[model samples]
Target: MTLALTRDELAEYLHEVFPQIRDDFAIDDLSPERITMRLLTAERHLRPGGTVSGPSMFALADVAVYAMVLARIGKKALAVTTNCSLDFMRKPEAGRDLIAECRLLKLGRVLAVADVLMFSEGGTDPVARASMTYSIPPA
Candidate 1:
C-alpha cells in the first residue's frame, strides 16, 4: 500500500507538534509496513552503567511506532498511545546511535498495534523490544 505521509512530512509534523523531542529522533525511512528511526544519542541518554537510559529507549520505541502509524494514516495528531510494553534485552552500546525498526501488526478502526526492535547502531542483536498500541481518535 502507498503511504499517506512521507518521511519528510512526518518529520516536519513531529518537529512542529512535539518540539521537546525534536532532537531526540529522526525518521530514517518509511515504507508500507515498516519504519526506521534513529536516536540522536548523547550523554544525557546514557545511564550509570554506560548504556542507553531506559527512558531513552522507551521514547525511541514510542516515536518509532507513532511514525509507522502516521505514515499509513497521515497527520493524525490525535492518535495517542493507549498501551506500551518494553523489554530491555541487553545493554546498548554507549557511544553508538540506536535504531528502531517498527512493524505494524494490526490496524483497526480505533487502535493500532506495532512491534519495535531496537538495535545499537551496527550491532546484530536487538538491545530492546517494544510493543505499542495507539488509540486513534474519531474522525
Candidate 2:
C-alpha cells in the first residue's frame, strides 16, 4: 500500500488531533511498511532510578504503531489499539531520547498489526520490543 501522509503532514495532523501528546513524539522517518519515531525524553519520563520509565517506553511503542497505521490509512483518528504485547529487554538511559522503529506486519480491512523495536538514542542494543494490533474503523 502507498503512504497516505507525508512526515510533515502526519506531524501536523497529530498535533491538530492529539494535542495532549503532540509534543512528546517526533517522526524521524516514514515509509509504506515502517516508521521511525523518537520520544523526546524529559525528566517527567524518568522513573525512580533515573531511568526511562516503562510507561514512557510503552507510549513510544504505541504511538509508533499508531503513526505507521495513519501513514497508510490517512487521518483515521478512531483507529484504536486492540492488543499490545511489550517486552522490556534492558533499561533505557535517562539522558537519551528513545527511538521506536515500527514495522507493519499486517494491514487488512479491519485490523492492523505492527511490531516495534525501541532503543536509546545512540545505542545499538534495543531497550524494548512491542507488538500491537489496532482495529480500524470502517470507511
RMSD of each predicted structure: 0.8, 0.6
Residue-wise C-alpha lDDT for candidate 1, range 1-139, written one tens digit per residue: 7798888888999898899998889888889899999999999999898889999999999999888888888888889999999999999988999999999999888999999999999999999999999998888
User: Which pairs clash (backbone N, Cα, C closer than 3 Å) in model 1?
Assistant: none
Candidate with top TM-score is 2
**Residue-wise lDDT of candidate 2 within 19-124, one digit each (tens)?**
9997799999999999999999999899999999999999999999988999999999999999999999999887999999999999999999999999999999
TM-score of each model, paired residue for residue: 0.97, 0.98
Give me the overall lDDT of model 1.
0.92
The candidate that achieves the highest lDDT relative to the unseen native structure: 2
Which parts of model 2 have CA positions greater than 4 angstroms off?
none
**What lDDT does each candidate get?**
0.92, 0.94
Question: How good is model 1 by TM-score?
Answer: 0.97
Single out the weakest 10-residue window by summed lDDT for candidate 2: 16-25
Prediction 2 TM-score vs. true: 0.98
